[model samples]
Target: MKFALSLLVGAAAAQCGKRSPSYLTWTADSFIEHGVEKNFHYTQATLYLGYEAAYELTGDEKYAEWYRNQIDDAVVLEDGTIKDWDYEFYSLDDYRIGNNFLWWYERTGEEKYRKAADIIREQINRHPRNQAGGFWHRRPVYPNQMWLDGIFMADTFYAKWTKMFDNDNTTAWDDILKQFVLIDSHTRNHTTGLLAHGYDESKTAVWADPVTVNRDSGSAPLVWDRAVGWYFIALLEAIQLFPESHEGHSILVGFYKDLAAALKKAQHKSGGWWLIMSEPYPGMEGNYIESSASAMFTYGWLKGIKLGLISKGEYYKAAKKGYKLLTNRFVRADDECLLNWEGTVEVGSLCCNGTYEYYISIPLQTNDYKGVGPFMLASYEWETY
Candidate 1:
């Protein structure tokens, strides 16, 4: 009787605190404010997505306004170009935030927002590509490189951009399709049906294959946590953007669903994914269960299930368990606040890190943005469904 009463009380308490996830509740445990080397982290898209999600869930005007300000701040006015990017040395990673501009433009009728998005999209168009029609991750500075992580970094943003204003641009659609084709060609390992961490287009870098130019960066070669997270999220976002009439929509959705199934299979039983996804030899450095990647997988699975791309029974249950483990052990939550998220989650690389220790060795810091947006997104999905 006592146990039942306690359970009831706990349940009631949970109900009382249940609210759709809001970025307002999330305080950056560490901030890049005041010129603190902000460029080191991939900014823009993920951060603005947090604010956009907050606006959607809470109807908070402040987040919407702040996001608009961020886009305005990032505009680059060099010699002759009114651009949102420095393409000579830029990565597709930053443009993901461009999706927010369209929504803001719709809300405010601001051509500047639309213009800013156009500028970014144009930058994507004008940027250098490798021999096979794939983007060169950033500039030649990151020469001969194409990380699996780069797929979500730009392509999802590209799809959203196309959805917004390129309904008539057949060439734009062709470009988007080509981008995916290039990624599928470079990263997809036909044997395991998983992505390698990245590929070196030139095969010249130390991490590159001297023969094929692919990055033989990690062990197992099954999949990596963060890299796979990028793939799943890209599929989810891109699928959402796909027009119903497109012949490829169903195919992409099927791929996403299958990827989710594969990911569920790879999830560590303790409710996370290993740094290196496949079962590994005993001495791998960072192959243990990782936090951000686990949270991302949980977010992806929950989002996929809620989006009707996957079944709820198993995916939902797994997400719930993963959330529990994250909140109970990995997360430092007090009074509805989260702290100490694992900041740098990189794996499937034989170079710098691929062992369980390397994954865990990336310091658990307060409110890293990598986990923040995804956790908030997952929580919002939880609240809704």
Candidate 2:
């Protein structure tokens, strides 16, 4: 979908544009996840996988160009030992991006891709660690806090980097394994079979659980859609990097299966997942379906099947149902050619406390990157499906 970066409205329309076309355009800002203006940093990492996938699928140079732009952002000097990117700015939260860059470098042998990947290695070289040596989510701020989001962002990058710059760098694997240990130790909900949004080691945030040592970062226990979506992608991405012989390999595979089983129970009767997972009561307020989260799940499940990570029989059926629902429910056409995409960030939201009212209140919009990118990737994954 073409990202709408601009819009036109008459004086009367501008006053009542809520009744008119309210659109979002392509931007360099990273906060366009749900078509919202957020204070998050836009890392080329998130776009990297989508761009590479797009390039290979469309055979278009523009996708390659987009990949190049991300490289440009990270490339620093003659030797990529130092990069222009500030480690203090954001941690490896976007590290999966490096795998894309490295893949591009391997494809073209462009020194910059290699050099840029090397620069990222340096960031890992100096990354701060927790007491168990788990890398902090970001440097210079939020020390010792491990966000579930960071695992996919960093581990996928590090694993591929290990194969590249220096296969001899066993420390990379150690770091990767330790990160899983830290997050699973802190965030796993044994009974519910889902992960919390993020974990704070210092217990500084008001959200941090004082007793169990976890954090209450995700607003709704209903499984914040995009947050878990980020995680699901991360899990598959990490699996690609591991050896079947690795100790965590089986454990991680089982983890994926168990999570999917739980998620299956939470899916909406209409084929999507409820805004507040684990509880979608009829005639309820917040217990409803969401777009982005559902799409992300669909994409991940399909990819998992392709990777041989799940039983194709039942899981494939669930995935197919989700695909039909997403395309039918979330997608809308535009004749004006001005706007062409839409996605609901989630069906519900929660704050103050998790409730039905909280789950269904999340705003929905079109062409949200969180939904669009994944949708494009998922569509490309199963064109025949």
Candidate 3:
């Protein structure tokens, strides 16, 4: 069945005008249009990262222009301050769009972009952390907890800031590395070699495992595909910014290799990953292949292979299968050129004991930024390959 799906995808690619279909091209426009209609937020910020990748791959000004306009709209004050941004909330999610500021600064040498990024850097400088030194996912609400999602939300941008602007500050490197190491130490399930969705240092969240606190630590119950997906992609992004001679660089590479191995094992025969990745045993209810996470893993694998962080053969094959499954099974297009990528869970969080039911209960959404962003990113990487 998987082989047949791969062949269909290959046929689709060949029949399209280019090596790949026009999904990324059309979807990029769709996402940008949606953002224009709605206010720009962190979600749109993330989608722009994928669009930025598309811009790099094709050098299309439309993609670049869309990103610039989105950033411009978000950070509108003459003084280069972000409009309507709430610094007091200290939510890691709010900081993701700062990545675009950094991107623009590097591209255009614009001081305004740098000034805008500084706002996020100041937030990170004062953001609270757990007992083990991992940043809290959010202030006041998710205290003493570190969600995998926050790693990408804050650290990727933080790492870039350190590399680009504060290279002389050696302690920034340590601060950056500590989050990954601490999170992995607390969250990883040694038996499965996969980390859980989140960890509560206080062991107080209803979702945190009481027994795990006594046995290991207070980690959440399930291995969520998108949470791990965030971690995987963040590791790759962070590694690029680390100095090769730094000990932290080796630590990150080790983590990435370990995660790549675990994900390689966890990938479904369908060439995708399950929403509850570790729960894929026969007939496990709600254990189904998810599109956004699948796209994220595909992007990570292909990018990892390209960067030589992992060996190519099996990782490349798995990536190929994932890209094929993504393009064939999930992606759809209409006559109006609207693109929809199906099977994305709109929102998943570690709330109320983190039960299996809780993981599956999140409503599925189509054309969601989480799904669309990774799909664009995966498409760009696949095209490059």
TM per prediction? 0.78, 0.76, 0.92
lDDT at position 259, candidate 2: 74
Candidate 1 per-residue lDDT, tens place, 53-83, comes to 6677778676665555555544422232344
The CA lDDT of each predicted structure is 0.60, 0.59, 0.80
- The clash numbers for all candidates, in the given order, read 16, 14, 1
Query: What TM-score does structure 2 among the candidates reach?
Result: 0.76
Off by over 4 Å in 2: 1-44, 65-84, 94-96, 139-141, 210-222, 278-284, 336-339, 344-365
Question: In candidate 3, what residue range of length 10 has the lowest lDDT sum?
Answer: 1-10
Residue 219 of candidate 2: its Cα lDDT?
19
Give the alpha carbon lDDT tens digit for every residue of 247-354 in model 3: 999999999999999998888888988788664432376556888899999999999999999878778888998988898877654444455567788878875668
C-alpha lDDT (0 to 100) for residue 102 of candidate 1: 66
- True-structure RMSD, every candidate: 6.4, 7.8, 3.1
